[model samples]
Target: MSTDSPTDGAGAAASVQRLFRNTVVAVSGALSRRDGRVSLSVSGLAYFLLYLAGLRHLGFGPSGYEVSVVSNPLVRAFRQVGPFQWEPIALVVVGPVELLVAPLNMLLGAVLAALVGLNLAVSIVAWRGPSACRLGPGAGAMSGLPGLLSGFACCGPTILLVVGIQASAGLLSLFQWLLPLTVVALLGTLLWVGSRVETAQQVA
Candidate 1:
């Protein structure tokens, strides 16, 4: 048996460096080198985190559910805008435009408006590194945690079953509503899977 040479260790080190460099370049394109990756990765992460955080502003949450059947704010807004007025100006051009969208529009304006507002709010706020860097990233990560668990095999139908049970009761506790919510999550998963399958088939 022969002992390893110093040249062999040097070659190994160089190979690792090259591999790391290539990986960074692939995710981040030309900008992945040095400090650029830090900035881009942080910002992208912030944007995604904020987007999920904004969903909290929706009427539903862990504490209690809003029992009202009224349209969500965004849906109301969309109705006011109408098909003809869907241009860029609708976001902040006029406050009174919301009034028009609320009652007159045929579609779900309030729900649409609320979603847009939530996403925009999250994007703007999360970009500032909101609070200290540590806290901000932590918060963002927590907000996104639900999306990760969604991949569990039982998560989909489990939710649907829970939701059905809650609906049967005619009144639901906070945790009880989770079933229906789970079902909705499952439906979203199915849709995503369907899309992927369709795309794959098309490619084939």
Candidate 2:
């Protein structure tokens, strides 16, 4: 048996810590620039709005101005209606705009949006900066595609599967895993993008 198991484990822990630290540093540095901030804000906002629109929470409807809350807003907010979905506890309408206020969903959307925004921010900054290593902004930009796709996957699982192909238990289970998979994808891509960016000390 290898007597260096403790050393190996310690090394693994240190590696993970270094990876996270580097990722954070890269993201922070990227977001510090004006162009990076603009990219982050625009991409994040667009994603969040599309996310809500996909969920039928935000759209154009009858013209009106009103705000209504469910009887138990707090309790209703956390009530799950589907895989990783919570019930909306309020409705807001302003002229032609309508919105369903679901706290949990909004929170998730924010997180996903931020991840995507950070990915783009870092990628953009890296591409514009002079780096010692070869960098392709496309790689980092495309990484967020899965997260975007998965967000739409949560809108509604395809009910019609090639007319006759039935969804198996395994396939059905996969639908439920989409959101979690997206989160993992987003974080993984963020780390990947961050790893390629300028380090904290080299940041300008």
Q: Per-residue lDDT of 164-203 in model 2, one digit per residue for the tens?
A: 3467867656665687877786688667655555444545
**Candidate topping TM-score:** 2
Off by over 4 Å in 1: 30-204
Candidate 1 on 1-204: residue-level lDDT in tens?
999899999999986665444333222321323333454445444433332222211122244322333445555444422222221212211222211112222122233223222222222222333221112233333422332344232233223443343343333233334534544564443232222221223335
TM-score per prediction, in order, is: 0.21, 0.76
The global C-alpha lDDT for each of the candidates, from Candidate 1 onward, is: 0.32, 0.69
Give the range where candidate 2 is weakest over 10 consecutive residues by summed lDDT: 155-164
Candidate 2 ranges with C-alpha deviation above 4 Å: 130-176, 197-204
* Shift in Å, residue 192, candidate 2: 1.7
